[model samples]
Target: MGLFSIKILLVLIIGYFLGSLNTSIIVGSIYGTDIRKHGSGNAGMTNTLRTLGKTAAILVIFGDILKGVLSYIIGNIIITAIPDSSTLYISGIGGMVGGIAAIAGHNWPVYFGFKGGKGILTSFSVVMMMDWKLGLILLAVFVVIVAITRFVSLGSILACAAFPIGAAIKGNGTVFILFSAILSILAIARHNGNIKRLLNGTESKIGEKKRA
Candidate 1:
């Protein structure tokens, strides 16, 4: 039991370290831009896209989301090794879970003075572990909403809301429900600028990208 517990803690520390690698900052630095100094002052995919180009944006998004997924897998594998939920190696499903840590890493990367993106991609990656089916549904919602409204913030916010919507519909336990609520709040916090622009009706559309 003690060994199993030690392993889980090891997973947590390793997962956090893995999550701390901030790709946005590296990409931005490569381009001679702080990225945070650019669009929305955020080190995120949107800012990368707006500042660099499509390729850079895609890479950043993929990398950020991948880190989340990979770290979750790391923790998940450790938990699985214990072969029972009663084991001390099991991790919770709350905000401090594998998914949330990834988001934390993105929003406040230890490698970069705790300055990072809002963790939207990392949040989405969380669903990948919870249930790819739900993730796909939320993803579809994200695409449709983003396509119709052309407002990235609106799409993300709505999709996040879908978490609770799906949970309530499926009669899920409180873990996912509580996670949805907190994820929504984090998403909102990350999009404070977009929120302002949205209030003013000046937020950019997908293709009509603007400089921050």
Candidate 2:
């Protein structure tokens, strides 16, 4: 009802729609295939790389990252535009809300039958936009884990779990930390299959070719 509430709602709606673009699926269709039906059945960069190729994967990464970044920007813009704002940190809250909605959309894209990627890249991009330093730290954490185990899923899981903790340690406000935690939970939940495979030592390692 209030202008602030309306702006926040608009940001969420726009962010989710942007995220629902589902870059991998779009690229797969351009190549006459459905990426979700191949490899790990994940419409993500890694699976796109395996099923399509480097170019398609790059496109997916770019598109996914773009949507995340745009969502944050749109959220910030919408909130900051409001006059006589009661909340001093409302812009940050808006950004977080938009970012999380985008991740949700990526994880379960409405445009693609509510099935989509794990939202790893989209979340990473959103966090990076929110706090570059923390984003770099998380990126380092992910790289180290993936480099050590060659398991992208494990890296993603651990990095996601660390986000809220890192935000807390950095003295972020409660809402920011809570939003980060939500992103973490969403990412981990989306990787449920990967977690099971990891426990069983059956999860595909990064760069592992799918058998034809």
Candidate 3:
């Protein structure tokens, strides 16, 4: 393969593997349990908190966030090493590709029976690395929605929905906007069950504990 192809392959492979780490699962294992079999049957930060405790949840969240940040950094580093690049736009696109790969891996981790978290935290981390301004805006939106509704899923959905709009408003390139839209769609799609429960008023609130 060519040099560019090699770089893209490396980015996707490394990013996906990093995301597939499934921090919650690893943390859960340390406690002699599988997080996916616990509360909400979801392997994520909130679920980790419900199943394990604050400490485990914090560790999982940190690991997941680092996955996104590291993927973005690794992609940019690879692209930077390549010669004959006239603009940094190529690196930006490469970083997006890597970030998307990580998000996908997080949503459906290959290491954990293809079941994983919704990718909200991972997406947020990636967006923060890509554009701090847009990241802060989305963070504000998430916090406001969660504070009012006390529904983390609602906050996540709204934040994901806002991502593409924020990118467009920030005058990001077409490729970036398109990638942001794709990420938004993926995030929302992963929360379809939560959306249904939300509409039916059966969704669990932020701090609700799952029945054993």
Candidate 4:
């Protein structure tokens, strides 16, 4: 394989493996149970907070965010280490590609029977790494939505929708805008059940206690 191709492959693999780490599940195991078996049955920070409490949830938040940041950094390192990589916007592209792979792995982790979190936190981290300005825009949108509605799902969905728009507004390249759109789609898709519940007015709001 060409050097560029090899670098891309390595970045993709690293991102996937890092995402597959599944912080919630790992934290759950430490607490003596499978987090997926309780609460929302979703292995993620929100569910972890509901099922395992604050400490576990905090750990998951850090771990998942770290996965995205590390993936981007590592991918960029790989791209920059090779000659002629800068000719194709390879640094940015590689980082975004790794970020995408990380989100994909989080959603359908190979180690977790292809069932996992909805990828919100990881997406936030990746977006931050890609462009802090865009990330801030999404974060503001998310915080406002969640504060007003108390619906984390709504915040996440709306924030995801804002990604591509924010990227475009920032005058990012077409490729980056396209990648942002893909990430947005992937996140919204993962929230399919939440969307249904939202429509039915039965979706759980943030801080709502999990039933026994």
Candidate 5:
């Protein structure tokens, strides 16, 4: 393989390994529980909170966010090393080879019996790589929705929707727009159960007092 190809592979490896570090699994092991076995039974931040309380959940959120950032950084470095990179503006998408690798890794972490949390953290990082401003705006939407609705799923869904608007505002290329759309789809698909629960009113709202 060419040198550039080699470099790209390295980036993907970094991203995948980093992404494979599932926050929920790590925390769950610490507590002698599989996060997926208790509470709402999801492995992402929301479920982590329901299972382990605020401190553990907050740590999971940060850990997940960091993994995303790491994946983006790995991919960006790869694209930048090569000339005439189409992924320059939103090059992170191409590197999403790495990003998705990471998310996939999280979903089925090698270290955690091939099961992991939802891709919420990866989505957060991927969106940010599209554009930090866009990512921040997306984060704002999630924050607002989650803060008011107490539904992390709603915030996540809304955040995914914000990608296109942010790309348009920045006048980014069609590739970024397409990338955003795909992410929106992935985000929604991952939340299918959460959406159903939300509709059925069985989904947990953030900060709600747990019943005995």
Candidate 6:
């Protein structure tokens, strides 16, 4: 295979494996329980916080964010070795590909029965690495929405939806924008259950513990 192809393959493989390392599951295992069996039954940061506690939740969320950031850095480094006139562009695309792979892995982790987090934190980190301006904008929107509505899922959905739009407004390449859109779609899809509860006014707000 060609050198570029080999590099791309390596990026995808590494990103997937890294993403598959679900922090919530790992933290839950340390406490002798499966995070997926508790609270919202979703093995993401919000669920971790609700099922576990602040320490475990913080660790899991940070770990997930690290997965995305590291994936982008590693992919950028791998693609940088290619001798091309468009090295910057190639690296940017490679970084996005790696980030997307990580998000996919987080959503459907092979290590956890194809079940994992909703990928919001990981996507945030990835977008930050991809474009800090866009990332900050989305972050602001998320914070405002969550603070106003106390609905973490709603905030996450809105932020994900804004990614592609922000990318487009910032004149990101078509491929990058398209990939962002795909990531947004995946995030929204993962939150399907939350969407249902939200519509029915049965969704859990941030900081509200699940009832026994």
Candidate that scores best on TM-score: 2
What TM-score does each of the candidates earn? 0.85, 0.96, 0.95, 0.95, 0.83, 0.94
Question: Global lDDT of each model?
Answer: 0.75, 0.90, 0.88, 0.89, 0.75, 0.88
**Candidate number achieving the greatest lDDT relative to the actual structure:** 2
Models ranked on TM-score: 2, 4, 3, 6, 1, 5
lDDT of 5 by residue, 1-212 (tens): 66556666787678778888999878878988888888766678877877788889888988888887778767877767666533334445546656766777777677777767778778878777667787888888889998899887899887887777678778887877776776677667777877887888887677753322
Put down candidate 6 lDDT per residue, 1-212, tens digits, no spaces: 66777788999999999999999999999989799998988888888888788999999979999999999888888888666554335438778888889999998999999989899899899989988988999999999999999999999999999999988988998888888998899889999998998998899899997633
lDDT of 6 at 136: 94
For each of the candidates, the C-alpha root-mean-square deviation to the true structure, in angstroms, is: 3.0, 1.5, 1.8, 1.6, 3.1, 1.9
Which prediction has more favorable TM-score, 1 or 4? Answer: 4
- Screening candidate 2 with a backbone cut-off below 3 angstroms (N, C-alpha, C), the clashing residue pairs are none
> Tens digit of lDDT per residue, candidate 2, span 38-109?
998999999999989899989999999999999998888888876755654554887888888899898889
How far does residue 98 in candidate 2 sit from its true spot (Å)?
1.1
Q: What is the per-residue lDDT of model 1 for residues 116-163, given as tens digits with 9 covering 90 to 100?
A: 887778888877677778889999999999989988878887788778
Q: If both were scored by TM-score, which would come out higher, candidate 1 or candidate 2?
A: 2
The regions of model 2 sitting more than 4 angstroms off are 87-89, 210-212
* Cα RMSD of predicted structure 2: 1.5
